[model samples]
Target: MVKQPAPDTTRRSEKSRRAIYDAALALVGEVGYPKTTIEGIAARAGVGKQTIYRWWSSKAEVLMEAFLDLGEQSAREAGQESYAFPDTGDLAADLKAVLRATVDELRDPRFEVPSRALAAEGVVNEQLGRELVAKLLEPSLQLYVDRLRTAQDTGEVRQDIDPRIALELFVSPLAQRWLQHTGPIDHTYTDTLVDYALYGLAPR
Candidate 1:
């Protein structure tokens, strides 16, 4: 029978995990995903290969979790929960606030480069793409779903609207802009998106 690691041992392991995440993000940003190896990450992180292998199966898995952790840290620094949505009673206000934060995050170098590497890889790698969408992207999107549902209940959103599709009207546009360099993302742009999506651009 194998005994669990001691508390100090666990703390040290966590420290190593953080170091590995930092190393993975940095290496991916500098070298891109194709050249990023578990061995390279371990060497840069000052840990053994077995340590990383014990925690994660592959470089892709390590980088995926690393990016997720990085996003969560950035969100926390921005005074927002990584997995929760802000509901300020006013739909437009809440969406604009959240999207403004997203714009800031997209511009952050620490978040931007690594995310680009991962997103680029996802576009070409089908399995990793699905895994990333399911594990990392969908969970974040569900927060929007929950918020939109609440807005519908309170009459701030149309009752017949599909929260998933409706939320994407604003969300996916920003994502596309950031991913493809399609346009500038800013507070004003996102604010306008909320207005257009909610009030309709045809006449109202």
Candidate 2:
């Protein structure tokens, strides 16, 4: 008979931590943020509630980490760096590629379900909303600003354009469609956004 090596504490702890993240995401997705408690996450994760308390100060903290981890995992599985926005010199093409990917991600059940729950809750919870923007959204947005700045230096974008606000012209519309269900999101839609954003409505 072959004997198996005893599972070490680090391995066991890591397994428990992954379980906690999965449980927190699924619970919030299924039962909204307000109803997702540490005890519930513990029960779902099959760990003691004290284990959660030891790691996180609150459910908000746990959920935030879980969402961040989920984004990183998705990026890894997709074979891309998390939020490393593409800058291939052709600014419009780069923006279109990134936005198309965003469209796919926004439509994915695994991301959309939990994100919708958190986004809705954030609207009411000022602190949670601020943290969500600070911890996740703003970092990604800054990438766009950086790219736009590079475009400005290259003379692709106008020199006086505020990269931060200019980015919102394309980014915000897509986000609105996803969050508000105002319209369908797809590669074509995002491509159109990039075109319209880069070229004005005025005729040549």
Candidate 3:
């Protein structure tokens, strides 16, 4: 069998990984995605370049993982068990809670700065946009899809409605408001979106 790293070595590796993540987030926020480089990350992280190479092959990979880790960190700070969406029986309440958490996250300076920079880059770079969508956005969107499917099964939603499309009814509005600065983003706003999307603007 191959030899494994010692316990202390594992701890050190973890420390280095955290440092790298922090450095990558900070640099991307400060300089934007195009200007951020692995060498800069290594320098800020106080690790050798080879250390980062051993873990990630490209700056995009490093930045992607860093953002993912930041999201997990935010979830832990919010006392969540993991990044998974809430699954309370009350679908509206669950969606509202998650959206409120999202509002908080969007308002956070650490998340907002780098996220804006990366999002701007994605608008111009089709390849990067696709990669980011696949790695980051799609997974989160799937949670909403899954919840909507459950609602359909239970008759909370119309049987013929598409879960994926139904999810966009609430989610897309919030995303557009946040990304475009067209309007405010808060619990009340998202609650309204959920209500309108589920119940419809016209009277039943």
Instruction: Sort every candidate by lDDT, greatest first.
Output: 2, 3, 1
lDDT of 2 by residue, 115-147 (tens): 999999999999999999988799889999999
Error of 2 at 84 (Å): 1.4
- Write down the TM-score of every candidate: 0.92, 0.93, 0.93
* Tens-digit per-residue lDDT, 1-204, candidate 1: 112335667777889989999999999888887899999999999999998887788898888888878888987887767766787898888889888888998899988998899889889989989988987889888888999999989998888999999988899899999999999899999998899999988984
TM-score of decoy 2:
0.93
* Residue pairs in collision within model 2: none
Native-to-model Cα distance after best TM-score fit, residue 80 in candidate 2, in Å:
0.9
Residue 77 lDDT in candidate 2 = 90
For model 1, the stretches where C-alpha displacement exceeds 4 angstroms are: 1-9
Q: Is candidate 2 or candidate 3 better by lDDT?
A: 2
Global lDDT of each model?
0.87, 0.89, 0.87
- Candidate with maximal lDDT: 2
